[model samples]
Target chain A: MKNRLKVLRAERDWTQAELAAALKVSRQTINAIEKGKFDPSLPLAFKAARLFELSIEDIFQDEVTP
Target chain B: MKERTTEAGDFTACNVKNNVRLLSWVFAWVVTLVLADKAELYEWHSSAFISIAAIVINAAIGLGVIVVFMRHLKGLDELQRKIQLDALALSMGVGLVGSFTYSLLVTAKFVIDAEVTDIILLMTLTYVVGVIVGQVRYR
Candidate 1:
């Protein structure tokens, strides 16, 4: 899975720590997700979507599918 | 977001408190054991009080450590829990196989001087390695 997390966070001027705080996760988790080292679970993806006010599809794309 | 941050902060604080408490208990338990061992070795077989105290304190501290560990595990996210479970399973498998192998070797007279502590240490080392491997696999 690939995601626009970094771009979205940048647009909102939110640091990884700030985003992690918002999501109730450790900063390492956010970093891992942004770096494509780990994929978020559906609930976490939904949380991110809610945070950014965007659909999950807008923030995350399935690289394997394409 | 603000509410969630506050919750996270609280969780971190709680984790730190639990960690500190657990460490303190373990430190006290180890110190007591060392002192007791030293007294026993020096022919200071004074009273059964020291032995009893050591046993009681160690059991209490061991229980505390387990409680804290379980609480910490319960607090982890799903993926984190899966990684930990995998690590634990791998460690247990290694521990069992290594113990049996060592026993067989001893029975065959292929090795000597193997003590119970060696198996405990081996299991601890394997568990640590398992944790590292599990983390890397998830990452």
Candidate 2:
């Protein structure tokens, strides 16, 4: 999944650590998500969307391949 | 998926630490065996005492290593935690099947005897399999 987590976090001026704390996850998880190294579970994705006050679709999109 | 950002250096360090601990355990056992042989300790009831002491010490050290590893794992991210859990589950499953198979073999008289070394080897194999499976699944 592709997500605009980095952009959202930047807009809010929140560091990965801050977002991670808000979500009750380790900072590494947020970093991995932002870098697209990992896709969060559904519940975690929803929690991230909720925390950012955005719809899940607004935050995440399916990856497109050629 | 993007590239997996594994801390290879940290992983290597952990592996090295475990190897060293294993070597130390082997050395301790060898030393105990030599002492028992030299002192003729195997001739008397003291043989059991030495054997039990060695076993207890090894078990304590093994448990200590496990505790330390678990504490380190507690610092890992969610992905790592999932990997660890999957690995542990695999280990347990493999261990159970292996143990059952050994028991069946013994019961059928396919094997004359089952020894402590056989059980240890089975456990080691289970752990190796678990680690391999975990790495593959996560990758």
User: Please, what is the whole-model Cα lDDT of each candidate in the order they appear?
Assistant: 0.80, 0.70
Q: For every model shown, what is its TM-score relative to the native structure?
A: 0.78, 0.53
**Index of the highest-lDDT prediction:** 1
TM-score of chain B of each: 0.81, 0.58
Candidate 1's C-alpha runs over 4 A off are: B1-14, B36-43, B75-86, B132-139
Model 2 gets an lDDT of: 0.70
Question: How well is each residue in B84-135 modelled by candidate 2, as lDDT tens digits?
Answer: 6777777777677878898899999998868856876777777777767755
DockQ for candidate 2: 0.15
Best by DockQ: 1
Candidate 2: clashing pairs of residues:
none
Question: Could you give the CAPRI-style class of model 1?
Answer: acceptable
- Candidate 2 CAPRI level: incorrect
For each of the candidates, what fraction of the native contacts does it recover? 0.23, 0.15
